[model samples]
Target chain A: MNDSQQNIKKNVLEKIRHGDVVMRPKIYFTLQVIVVAVVAVCAFIASVLVVSFAFFSLHESGELLLLGFGVRGLLTFIALFPWVTLLIAVGLVVLLEWLIRYFKFSYRQPILKVFFVAVCVVCVGGLLITFTPLHTNLSDTADRGDLPFIGQLYEDVHMPHEDKGEFRGVVVSVATSTITITHNDHDADADDGTRVVTVPTNFNTSILHIGDRVYVAGDMTNGTVTAYGLSKF
Target chain B: MSDSHPPYPTDEELVTRVQHGDQEIFGELMDRYTEKLSRYGRQFLARPEHIEDLVQDVFIKAYQNIQSVDTSRKFSSWIYRIAHNAFVNALRAQQTAPISYFDFDTFTAHPVYEDGHAERKEAEEMRVLVEKGIKKLDQKYREVVMLYYFENMDYQQIADILHVPIGTVGIRLSRAKALLKKELPVDTTHI
Candidate 1:
């Protein structure tokens, strides 16, 4: 080889030999393995919890025992847990291997394959745990009357009339696209003292009817009330 | 001179040592493969800046995942596989960005010889020209030429490293040689 060519080869070799490419330490690898194992355990626990919750909910409602089958359902689920976990674990490992091979990750960065496999195992374990027949408690529904703005909106819009010392109620009804609500209140005053208001319906205001609770803003004239805006509560 | 140790250890021995966490053995593997790997990277990627990075990545991966690799399989092939994967990934990443150029003048200016002589100047000029010529070739042709000429890889080994058919490697090498011949100075008596 020519002197320059030889020099180039030598230079290239020296550079290759001395070049620093930082890599994750062995401790990091060990930690990664530990974390993966922990994640798998946690995932398995989660799966078991899910199964148990489903089972407990069913059992407490007496649904499992009602059809003359007591403890058999629970016993069968318990018996199958191990097989299910094992299947899940095996599936996880297979999926991990397939992914690693398919992506050629091991060829690129080998440790990445190990990390991904561990993650897959954990995910599978979690799935196995969640598939168990365990119960999850449902929260109680809130009372609708306790909601804000409903009672005030109800009182302002509804009017009533009195006849011979007996009060007759004027009910106001409000309808939207999905719901309709009605409110009724009694007033001692009769026809001459009472006023009815008709508000124009725009984008914001709608017509009020019997058994409807509405909030109105405007003036009450001689036996005629003019409303500026009407809102249904 | 030939009495004691072989010039190169057997592939199996090297693999065993590497598996046992012999960092020097891993470095030996790097020394053994770097040229071929660099040429492969340069040819496939068409980028000089990424060549060393790709080579280093290949070696590191080989070291870390040596267990999964079958011991009976050719170590060179396994190393090449790692290099090839790294190069392909780097190439894909490059596609999304603009190409960058290195200062070749600065690279070639470093004197190869300490003696101040007219012959050294001529050789330096030729070296510069040759480097430029190699850089000018199409990425694929340049890689095959570099591997064949600079790294001294046979057609089959080049084919294995490149994951190409042996015939394809032969054809490419012939084409690359023809192209280099045209690019180089046509002196009847000189190399």
Candidate 2:
């Protein structure tokens, strides 16, 4: 309210009136708005995709630690989880919600409420998106080496644990720290592969009920495979 | 606000005129809000120099995106929302003076006022202390206090401007006052 400040403001207005500054063309603002909208939507979709990817990854990394690599490989596999994807997903969701805060209506509601609602919607959308054939289609595309980064990400997440030992069969026996699996890769043919493999696992081994389709990875010699990794196929 | 536009026009009508290419009315808006926005910017923004720039930027942006304005909503809230975003981004860009990095988490949790209802009193001394307290508070608290008292906006209006729930507006205001009451050593009524 000082005389000097008021004079400065009046001078600024006079300058504005006398064409010292020009308003941006209408199209520029329109384009800016359009770009913001597009970025917000893209951020939302990315969050959903990354969140779903994390979901599937978590589902695969069972709590049962198979002692095939003497817990080292188990530790590695656990660490190599789609954590980055999950983290990025969370970060994306937060970003999208933040962007939404700029909108007229979004600000009327509490941000925590907006954030929780946005997160739930994104998670549900991600789950529904997972049900699409896109996952399989993506895998197929990744298999042919068509997509680059996505292919690598898909390979890292979905490709069976081939780095160690890869075998799928049904559990025949369950011990305190070990589960015996009968290997049967080729069906309706002669028994060429290992007949049985004893896989040492963590204490939550009660999940290894006999007749369950299971996959195990470890050292296999003369049909005796000392397992390191185990998962429900 | 008139700028020779006859009797006062609603902000929505003025914005409509701008949308229809009557861009001069945008200046009317600039005239109306510049001082208010400047005061608001000073409350939370660390750099006082950027406040005028921020106000000018907000007007330019508002002028540009006049088409996107929803006529049903209050035009003042819409523009205030822009100012809020501008200040927030300005603060974020000021990495050298990183003030209250976690202020956004103000709405992430409980409404402390819900458990303990906050009383509304207006003491001249309290008001002065509140002004000093605003500068000392965190970004989130300072904003709600400024929006509530300085800008003379209600909780819903504050929520609309800040994009938070109305309840969050109350919680923030209450918590902000409590912090002020504690920090400024005002009459102690807040639990």
Which of the numbered candidates is closest to the native, going by highest lDDT? 2
lDDT of 2 by residue, B129-181 (tens): 67667778878888888877777677777777876666778778777877887
User: Number of the top candidate by TM-score?
Assistant: 2
Write the residue-wise lDDT of candidate 2 on A1-233 in tens digits: 44534544555556547766455566776787788789999999888887776665544433233434456656655655656777788789889978886665675555677778989998998888777776757766765677687776655444334345555567878777666766543223344243365655553677778898776666768757776666675
How many residue pairs clash (N, CA or C atoms closer than 3 angstroms) in each of the candidate models, in the order given? 25, 7
- List candidate 1 segments past 4 Å from native: A1-233, B1-8, B20-24, B34-47, B68-73, B95-132, B188-190
DockQ each:
0.03, 0.29
Cα lDDT listed for each candidate: 0.48, 0.68
